[model samples]
Target: MALIEYRFDNLRHDRIGSRGIDLQSLDRRSMEQAIAELRALASQKDITFPRLPEAPVEPIIARAAADRKDFSDLLVIGIGGSSLGARALLSSCTPGNPGCRVHVLENVDAHEFERIWSGLDPERTCVNVISKSGGTVETMANFLTVRQRLLDRFGVQGVRDRVRVTTDPESGILRAFAQEEGLVTLDVPPGVGGRFSVLSAVGLYPLAMAGLDVEALLAGAAAARDAALAPEAESNPAICFAAHQVALHDAGTRGLVFMPYATRLFDTALWFVQLWAESLGKVRRHADGHTENVGPTPIAALGANDQHSQLQLFMEGPADKCVLLLDVEERRDLRVPAVPAVLAGLQHLEGQSLDDIRAAELRGVRAALTEAGRPNATLSLKDTGARSMGALLMFLQCATGLAGSLLGVSSYDQPGVELAKRFAHGLLGHSDHAHLRAAADRAGQGKALTSVH
Candidate 1:
């Protein structure tokens, strides 16, 4: 099988003639150092992401198989890393799986909260609440809301029967609650953080239970991890991807433009946005004792669609964007049948397929961007199937890991997010954050707006 191909032809200054980096001759010692750092992180006793591609699938399968009889719908409850990967997967792949739809509750917005609450029957729905820390405020809020729905319908006994949790193995409030209630619990490995936990039970259990091929997905990721580990810098796509992104960032490119040519892969871009933004966007630098803020903003756009809306700005607005184009060889296609002789003006579309048209549009934009001297790269997939999707995810994950290493930032931790969580809890009357709430009240007391009524 042809693995996804990443070509940097459009990213070279020789091709763009000015805006790009000469990654071909640049010293790779730094790249090697970054990889070494990544290896060091993997070697540390506390991390699990490096070995995630090879994570066992049997346990996940068994859990899914066992839960299939009682739950028709899988309701994933969590925010950010907890739900993004699973959402992306089910969004992109579940159309082909002969299984019940997966509903994800990632926010506390009234509409979203009530929509999911109303759709699921507590008796038939399996609620998988995933939170690595088990105390993420938004996740906990959703879990409580959903738990009550179950309680109201099936009472305490049925609530335990339909509920499961994927969280820290030994600690956290969720852990304590699960153990106390005798809920089926799956461990969210200590080493694997939420964003990187897809290969673990956090993602696998729901997918496998939904009747999708978890092994094939893992196999694809394993292949990608192996490919990324290739010692040769030029041949390792992960290394190259990291290098290009770093070089561009250092060269003053402020935005990472991910515009895929396919519509189905849009959520993949959203998933990448979270992975890229949350992981690489950092302040503390381990390499040099760090800058307070540094990270490329990730922008998502869909081809043929965004071409009309965002292409103008990208082409003429600023030279601070690096475009990454992606397109898959269409797995299925529909022909534009010959038009009636009475409608002769539309003959140009006759006999042409939508896939053919889309592919051409994809090529056209790549050429247009090149001609515009826009630094870019293209990730071409042979097909938009699980294997290639798995490879793409793993490739990007490896790239993100190395890119953070190069930037000297902590890729796995989100120290800044903790402040907001604390402030939010304080506002909500949580005793632990009471002091923060007091501080917030003091801070906001004098800031009320004065306006003419």
Candidate 2:
């Protein structure tokens, strides 16, 4: 595959000036060293990635694409990684192709559920309930609500066939329920986490249902894995990225934002956010066991959309943020001018093609962000397809792990999220009003909340 070259040198000075960081003399040598170490680790971990079966999954994917079932809609019930990865893949791949609608329900917002329920025909919709643990409160709740809706609309038989599950093997409430209820099932690998599961069945199944090329996607990921596992700093994209980002963080840049130019990539940014945050946000302890808070804060923004909204804050706000700009190199649909005579007078503007206009706009945005002193990096995709997307996802995941290692954090575990889960369970399982009252009191004290009392 041809490597997408970056014009980093052109933007480097402007980025440094904007962020007030002199990265000119930053040790690129250390980055090279870190890359070497990470490459070795990646090579050693064979168990990290298992070969996906070629036969059964391929047939299922084909069948799903062919059998448009009565379901005009699909509601994916999952939280965090389970939801974000698949949502990102689906959104980016299906721009303007509105054969069927895909909605993701990850939160317990009643209003959102109500809206979805009102719009969807339960008989005509398939609900993909995804939970690695099978007992995630938010996911299970959404599943139950949707299941009930199905029961009400299409009766028992419809519910049995329409509801599908993606989860671990022979464990969790979801797995058991899927078996007992005889719903269609997909196995989520035990070793994979939700954020790191885009190339797995968790993401592939949905993308397949949406008529995406899962084979191309997996091939892309495999290619990326090869590139990331290579030792050379100049050759290994993931390592180079990791080194550069870690060096930036050490230089006092703490805020990281992913800004994708296309609207489809907005959800991709969210998926990246979870992967970066869950991996890097940690308190590193010294040899003496003393710990310190040190991690990059991750944020996501849509390109032209946020260019109008949040670009102001990014440009004028604190000078501690690093931005990653994702640019798609090819667009399938191009809007052309009906006639060259539409815009006359201005010599430069007259007879300008739509593609020319779009190019100019994108260039202008990059130039503006660079001039504003934002340290921005760009990732260009040759085209938006399953292969390129899969490559991108795998590349980001490897880069994230390397970046975390450089920052001295365990990039695999998420202990903080477990705390929230525990607290939520306590509140839900117990009949004690004290805990609820305490939460309410805290909420009331916060200025953001509207208090009844």
Candidate 3:
């Protein structure tokens, strides 16, 4: 059986009426061509992310074990791809585990820094500064602030002992600084971008410190990778999913709502948002030199809870969304108490397992969406274990790469985000970006049509 069970029945014309995808009418040749491109890319040395699951775990395990022996807490300093993958992995796998605790500082909020800093013992906390380029303003700011705190608490040598750096192996500011300071360092792999570096030292190191089975995580990812490389598109989940998404997007589905019913998997959905939005959303220049803006807007949502919060809009407000519902076959659950005489409306929930009730909610929502002529699909997992989470992450990443191919855009680059960063640097008075800063100021001088005080 597949690690994830993908059901597209509700996304079919027969199930969801006029708005659903017609399987027979899908452009199979284009999808097959995209899959072929993905296959070719996977074999290239420049694209290393697809091969990350097969990387050796011994070094990461050894380093993590050593760090865990000395530190009681880990303060991670990074943002975006540098931190999201680790955060998702730790959140999903290490909850309630009696292991070294992890505290991540991804934002520049002073209050958040203070809260995390005040809770740690500098002596027992190890600071991990991650940046593939080592030039991220937010990450550098947090790293500097935290580094000073460690220096204040402990001497220079002590700071060296407690701090680590993860960035490009040979270049970048962080790499140079680590070499000069003699601090422990790990590489983020040469060709792997930040978003796709999770299965590398970027994510594995922290997960290992958190007492998660990093090997098992890779094992699950490897299984998914093999399935992704299958020649038959029908048996390949990633290709099939990419084809479905491309077909739906072409059919006027502008929003992709990723709703996973499990709370542990919520961050996974958020991770998917960045992966999908950044990778596929692009302005592409065709062979004729004509450019066009493309890609779907990805919305991250939690289930059962969002049923009350966002379901109303998804059900009745918009006809431009295609929902991907994630359901986990939970291994542990609780049963509701017997019905009470005073509460009659709630009687049906009594004596039912919480998951059983959740299953009903999932089913009801799927039915309601279908009845209303909305397209949706379910990706069910066996459980939310380390293996399952690993498989899910890899599967989504592969699907995203294939989707980028279908859209005729480069999946790994984020030129829009880079442009914004440049503007921010200019606005912040960076010597190199002074021209940009002046332009930004000029743009800001324009008056608003209306305002309220």
Model 2 agreement with the true structure over 1-453: per-residue lDDT tens digits = 343433354235544563444446555666566666556554443324323322236645654665355567777788888889888888777432334577888899999989877887776677888998886889898889888877887887888878878898668888888888888888776656677776766777677667677788778777777787666667678877776677777778888888887778888899988998888888887889998887888899877777788888877888778777778777444445344555574556545655456556667767776877777777888766877887788888888877876777878788878756655665676454336546644654756756587
In candidate 2, which residue pairs get closer than 3 Å at backbone N, Cα or C atoms, i.e. clash?
A: 18-373, 71-124
lDDT of 3 by residue, 154-271 (tens): 8799899999899898889889989999999988888898888889999988888898988888888888877887777877888889888888998889999999988888888888
Which residue pairs show backbone clashes in model 3? none
The TM-score values for the models, in the order shown, are 0.93, 0.85, 0.97
Q: lDDT by residue for model 1 over 1-453, one digit each (tens)?
A: 366889888899988977888966655888888777766765676647777766666777888888886678889888887877877677666434566567888888879888777887766788899987777878888899888878887898998888889999898888998999999998888888888887788888777767777777777887888777777787888989988998898888989999888888888889889899989888854456545677888999999899999999888889999989987875565889879889968889888888889988888988988999988898988776667777788888889998887777878888878898899888998888888977888877876689888
What overall lDDT goes with each candidate model?
0.82, 0.73, 0.87
Candidate 2 Cα RMSD after full superposition onto the native fold (Å): 4.0
Better of 1 and 2 by TM-score: 1
| Model 1: pairs clashing at backbone N, Cα or C within 3 Å | 48-191
List residue ranges in candidate 3 displaced over 4 A. Answer: 94-98, 449-453
For model 1 the local lDDT of residue 345 reads: 88
Report the number of the highest-TM-score candidate. 3
Report the alpha-carbon TM-score of model 2 versus the true structure. 0.85
Q: Model 1 — which ten-residue stretch has the worst lDDT?
A: 92-101
